[model samples]
Target chain A: MNIDLFFIPLQIQDELSLQNKTVIVVDVLRASTTIATALKNGARAIIPVASIENAVKYASTLEPGSFLLCGERGGKIIDGFDLGNSPFEYTEEKVMGKTLIYASTNGSVAITKTKYAKHSLVAGFINISEVVKFVSENSDDILILCSGKLNRFCIEDTVCGGMIAFLLTKGKSRKRLNLSDSTVSAIKLYKFYSKNLLKMLRESEHGRFLIELGFEEDLKVASSIDSIPILPIFSDGVIKALK
Target chain B: MNIDLFFIPLQIQDELSLQNKTVIVVDVLRASTTIATALKNGARAIIPVASIENAVKYASTLEPGSFLLCGERGGKIIDGFDLGNSPFEYTEEKVMGKTLIYASTNGSVAITKTKYAKHSLVAGFINISEVVKFVSENSDDILILCSGKLNRFCIEDTVCGGMIAFLLTKGKSRKRLNLSDSTVSAIKLYKFYSKNLLKMLRESEHGRFLIELGFEEDLKVASSIDSIPILPIFSDGVIKALK
Candidate 1:
């Protein structure tokens, strides 16, 4: 297994070149969790937009009332959008059978960048096992791209990425794995922070910023492991729950 | 104290902005260790050039027998240079009272990028405490720049940067320091590998590469904590031992 981990998606020089590799885009603070929750709660499909302008533009094409315009700028709902980025707002009652136009500060940008990946899976602690199982069974070359907070490194995302890497390669012979330096550092971080993930998230820079915004409960929602057991795959610019 | 650590110097947006901040450039595999070695061995002053052309150009201006052209490419001595990037070659008798023009693949590039820094200190395990002390007594806003292997992350540099961070802020109240996520990650790595740094270096990707190239002994030179007991400060385009 050849595993490469990037602390931030900005490190990717040519996103389309990743078309041959299984790319796992992780955003633990909210995006991945919100996507999983929206899908698990019966959202029809998610159109992840890189910018607010794109989100609004994409929403315009959908029939009125069939889609919900959603996103956050600086952790608050964009003015005039139907919903914010918080997972709680993505509950079944609001999303069921509706196409969601989603834009986020970091996660959506990262997800959109992986449109050319052979298989791009959205992952967070909420659906760790499903993503891990999928990668282990289907991938020989794996790239775990952390959606850092707007081009800067985010501890929560890297830690989550590390956890996925650790679980996938744990107990395996070292000879079979070609891991990068960042991957090795990441796995070591996973070992250090895995004991109490909720605490880890609460202490993270982005997590603290979220808490300061009165979204502490969002941390709890994002930290639950395997609660939403589904792989939300990104393909051809749309995200949907993989059956 | 506010501390920010970057895995590679590429992260610096404006290298001139570092002119107000004390920058510690660490390349544990060789550059830093060799710089410290040359200074400790009584080289008049070391001029670290970014590229071979620059090194040769700078060397031509100095009087013959007063300066030596030194550097390495692929861990071997560059043709027509007096020395390679090995600490063992920089004995007191060889470098005494002579200015040296130095260049290396990664470290020298990073060192030159910090030309505008208030003070750029060369650091490695060989002279860690002195680097730490210089940072502790002199500056609060600190930047630890890891000279990663040619823009790609190298575990050894990050580990060395982490060790400096760990030693500087360990046991201090968290309220005192504003560290970035990468800083927190680096310190954790320092803690994880502190027990046996030599073994960690031996296993790192760059370390293994150095060993494969018959520089296994160089790792021993680089990994010796506080053995050199000197701080090589880069200032006015030249590096010299801090008095």
Candidate 2:
């Protein structure tokens, strides 16, 4: 199967042409893990917005009792947002049956960019095996798009993309991992770092950024492979858990 | 000293905002190498352009017969261009005392993006020591911008970036690396693959792309470290030898 890859920094979202492609939105740090955990814990739905303003406006339209404001900026929760972008904040009772209007500095911007995609699936190392299985079952052509930090390449996302490429290439050699230079390097990186996911995340730039912001525990949650099976797909501009 | 690293993929040219920063343009595959070699081989000046059309348009403004056109696309020479994007082709006899209006699929696009920088220098593995020395002498924040292939993170560029970071951060426990995740990973990849530079290049996706396009020997040219030492810096949108 033919697969395309996009490494997006948040600034170039307007230039992305994701139509007719199964766009996999990968934000390995926290968004994918948080979304998966929220859904697995029975969170009703997650609405991703590009900016905090949009999240606030979208929440105003929803029933106040059922919707909660959420998101982060500069790795910290917004001053008045109900939730910070941590997986731990998404417990079953706290999130269950409640719609979360989520926005974050980078992840939400990436999700919002792919809102027009034919099929957009959120991926992280945490649920990679499931992602590979789903993509293999629905294989036609794919775009492995990484949600880089503000229009720059982040090691975690590229490594995660590399992991997906590695699994797909290893599962069946016939698929011909016809990849770009970046893809080849990423696979090599995944091979080198996949042996220790936690260590890789802990030493990364964003990892340190999150750590400085006191979100070290989230890295552990995000790094756990194949822990969640739900696919967070974006359609009609809403990200809902897909079983 | 603070360093702000930028991973410049080809597609994000217009968005490059290098106001009042020392920008280093990196294209480890060939352009950076070619420019260094050309400058070292006694070429008077090299002009980088984003596209073949731009190269032609810029060359048109130069005195007739004063400049030669150079560049490549898909790793080969563009039709009617005077030179393809390869260092070996830029011998002393061909380039001496002449202006090269150069363009490539990736490298030149990245260089053009940094036109607004306070200072712009071309970088490659070949001149690592020289580049490092230049960076060390300057106390201003250093921007290691990787000219990713077609707006994607190519391994060679990242590895090169990592090498720069490693060089800067080695043996200094007091001074933190404070690098982006990509920077940290690039250094690790460089250390992982430093034993065999050509082998790493040959196996890399970009290397293979070059090989497939009949530019296999170009990889050898690119792999040779410290083979060229002359620095090419851009000022007033013009690149000239730094004597």
Candidate 3:
């Protein structure tokens, strides 16, 4: 079956997930990865909000002690934010049994934008295997949407999208997989790039931007594929998963 | 030097170009490659217009007999267009001395957008080497703008953009060639996937879209690296050559 993939900037694609497809939203530079990792590390759940204002507003409705605010902008922790956007930052002690009221420059906003999707899942290198498995079993026309940085194409997200497409198309006929030109190219890119994921990550545009912002360590965690195993689904405007 | 690479969809990216830096806009499927190939094949100046309306209006000003209206949307020739977007259709006989009033789905619109740029050039695999040489010799921070299909991130364009970044940063220090995560990932993608540009083209979103529309031949033409050596630059809303 033909699958449609959209490698959209977070600002634009988040709104697209509601179009009634099985949407796999990828935000490789830690949002998707972090959420997956946080869930794996025993965090209770994650709440993705569109903005800091929403995070603040939502936090008020939840039990104050039950939730924690987390987000970043320009790759740094928003001033007064409880957490910044790094997989390493979402530690067991911090995220355990707490609802993360999350906002970020790209990923979180994109995730929330997918609230209306028939089936929405946060995907990253960390949980690629699980996400792919889920999609393969479900067998719907998939939309592997990339949460690009602020509505612009970011390389990391597309690579992850490509990787996912590669996994799905293996042992399959080209005719069986209906794909867009960009989708086919991304899968090819992932196949070409699978040999050196870490090197690829280290040299990416967002990678260097984060390094400059003193988050160089984040790349290592983001590049580790399938290290974390969790399915983060978006439903009812919140993201939670079954362990 | 820090280069900010923007991967915007053609819908909006056409409006954003480098006013200071040299801008190299890529539409690898055919437009950029076609323009370069046409110029090399001895077509007298290809005229790129953003819309079919403009193409028709421009032809009226010229002797109608000396010009041809050409372009496609959703991968077929527009109604009443003199020629489709396939390079095979643009033979020396059909295009020689004939000013092409060209308007394409994504590429020409992007070229039109770079009117305010310090320097703008159309790029595709066909003329990537020539475009890269031109940019490297100029040694300005280049915006390798991809003309994505309809304001969306098309994978073919990103890979093409990555190829540009890879060539630029090769044999250089990681520090000297400061890259965004997007840039680094693009380079890695090129390195991994450059093994088979033809295979890559055959499977892209735009490539398949073209093939479905009976322009599979155009993919071969677009994927031929440096096949055409002309550098088509955009200045004051017209494409000329820095060459």
Which is the leading candidate under lDDT?
Answer: 1
The alpha-carbon RMSD values of the candidates against the true structure, listed in the order shown, are: 2.4, 3.0, 3.7
Q: Candidates' DockQ values? A: 0.63, 0.50, 0.40
Model 3 spans with C-alpha error above 4 angstroms: A1-4, A10-18, A37-44, A60-66, A87-97, A152-155, A170-175, A179-202, A208-227, B1-17, B37-45, B57-67, B91-98, B151-175, B179-196, B223-227
In model 2, pairs of residues that clash are A9-A151, A10-A151, A126-A226, A205-B181, B10-B151
Superior by TM-score: candidate 1 or candidate 3: 1
lDDT tens digits by residue: candidate 2, B1-243: 556566555434454456767878889899899999888887888888887778888987899778889999888889998888888889999998899988888888888888877788888988887888887787666778888776666777777777887888778673554566666667778888788888888987788888888888888878778778767898777788688
Q: What order do candidates take by lDDT, descending?
A: 1, 2, 3
- Tens digits of per-residue lDDT, candidate 3, A202-223, equal 7666777888888877888888
Q: lDDT per residue, candidate 1, B133-169, as tens digits? A: 8888875488999998766778888888999988999
Tens digit of per-residue lDDT, candidate 3, span B55-170:
88888898758878889888788998888888888888788777778899888887777777778878888878887787787766667777877776666777888898888777
**Number of clashes recorded per candidate:** 0, 5, 22
lDDT scores of the candidates, listed in order: 0.90, 0.80, 0.78
Which regions in candidate 1 have their CA more than 4 angstroms from the true location?
A: A56-66, B56-66, B78-82
Of candidate 3 chain B, the 10-residue stretch with the lowest lDDT total is: B8-17
Docking class of 2: medium
Instruction: Please say which candidate is ahead in TM-score: 1 or 2.
Output: 1
